[model samples]
Target: MAELEPEARDRIMDVFMARYNALHATDYDRFEDGPKGTDHDYLCVSSSGKAPLKVQHTRAWADPETEWRVPKDVERLIVHALQRRLDERKICDRHVSIRVDSFPPKRREKLALLEKIWMAVEFGLNRDWSNPSLQRLMRYERNDWTQFYQPISPYVAELEILERVPPVQAPALVGWSATGEEGDGVQDAVFRTVEALKKKEEHYRGTSADLVLVIDFEVMPYFQDELERIRAALAARSIDFREVWLVSQWLPVSADQVWPAPNVQSADAP
Candidate 1:
């Protein structure tokens, strides 16, 4: 795969965002030319203006969002975009594609993964690449690499291979992953909720009534020790869990029905 031309990168994002707006009509609205603190080409929000979720703006997939393994070409676009953010906090929206930073290979690799391990974990894109319908979220037309969204797909399936979601005698935890991967800081996330509730913080009103934790597959190892503690605390609280899903692992589906992806072979990459 060759690096994404600046034109291709922008177009790809526009297509995904267009779909995003159509799907999240009530929940989000899209914007261009970057919003105040966002510093990216696109921004969207719900909740009277909150962080946007997938379809995560493509550039964001390289920033506050976790990084994934990408083909060399598309990876170049991400590097170029991040440089603008790290340097001037400005992105040129015209004819600017196909630039890979000249960092030592190791340094670039570290930077690529740096955006990961933040809070949420992702999987499944590669799993369904063989399916044509899933192609948009998995294989890229511009670079034949993986496609991912920030905030994860709200529709991802949660397969509880082991631990069951705790009934919350408490409220859902009120923090993003401090470390990217949810399990790494699962305890902190839980304790944060406990503290807020104990203090009777009005802002946390009604949280004590339920706890919803979204754990990612990568966060699994971190849970090896603390999952039990979390379960015990929630058990004490008797909060009913809303849902527990393994995100990005299964073919996507919305509240209405599952989306079918077209089956395309790797040989089909242009």
Candidate 2:
């Protein structure tokens, strides 16, 4: 169903979490402590950083702000919370993430990023969106930049943590929307995928090998087409991903990055 009630959505998230756990053995839990104003369905974290449970889901993408954008106040609230965690030595070391099951499709990464730059300019010149908290939001933007809320209207999105990976290289967080129908089929996949690359490009400064975009088989028919578009998108930017897994088992249907990404482990294989 396109529009699911809150309860139903939570249940769907539960099912997905179960599939993820079966494959990766995770101890998932309901995420209650959201970033103050937003909502989340589940959460998880790991100190080891290897396969750390990301609070964000692995299903298709939904945009809460498709029609109503997230207001500036609410956006600041989200930013403040993320910045707080970014500075927290404990959370960073602990590996944290806040997942969302529903939300509006993300604005084009290029456009959304340009908007962030514009907001920065607003604060830089003391124009609109000049709250003091926003100033703090900018202070730690690099450490924990995310796409939780877009300014103007409120829309639910993922609140992933950028827990640093190693002393030499920093941790990079990735947000993905594998739902093909949301973006008019393969084109939007290209958009979201490239948008992700753009964020990493700007943040990582040309070298973003640590960056990854986990896509799924939400739109099964266009998997190959979407994968091709993603490849083209990466080539256009002169960047590559850490890896792209075919997250179909958790989805309604089954698919892989191009075909079936080896489901090598049997349910009882291990």
lDDT of each: 0.29, 0.36
Predicted candidate 1 versus true structure: per-residue lDDT over 1-270, tens digit per residue = 113356544444344434444443544544344444432333444655755542212111212122233334334434343334434522121111121122223656545543431111223211334434321222111232233432222211111111112322222111111122334323352453343233332433554223222222221212223444544554576332232111111122111101111122111011
Error of 1 at 205 (Å): 22
Candidate 2 TM-score to native:
0.28
Residue-level lDDT tens digits of model 2 in 219-262: 23234446665554555554444433334333243333321222
Candidate 1, residue 184: the lDDT equals 30
Task: Give the C-alpha miss distance for residue 249 in model 2, angstroms.
Answer: 14
Best by lDDT: 2
Error of 2 at 63 (Å): 9.7
Off by over 4 Å in 2: 1-5, 8-12, 27-42, 45-52, 57-186, 196-270
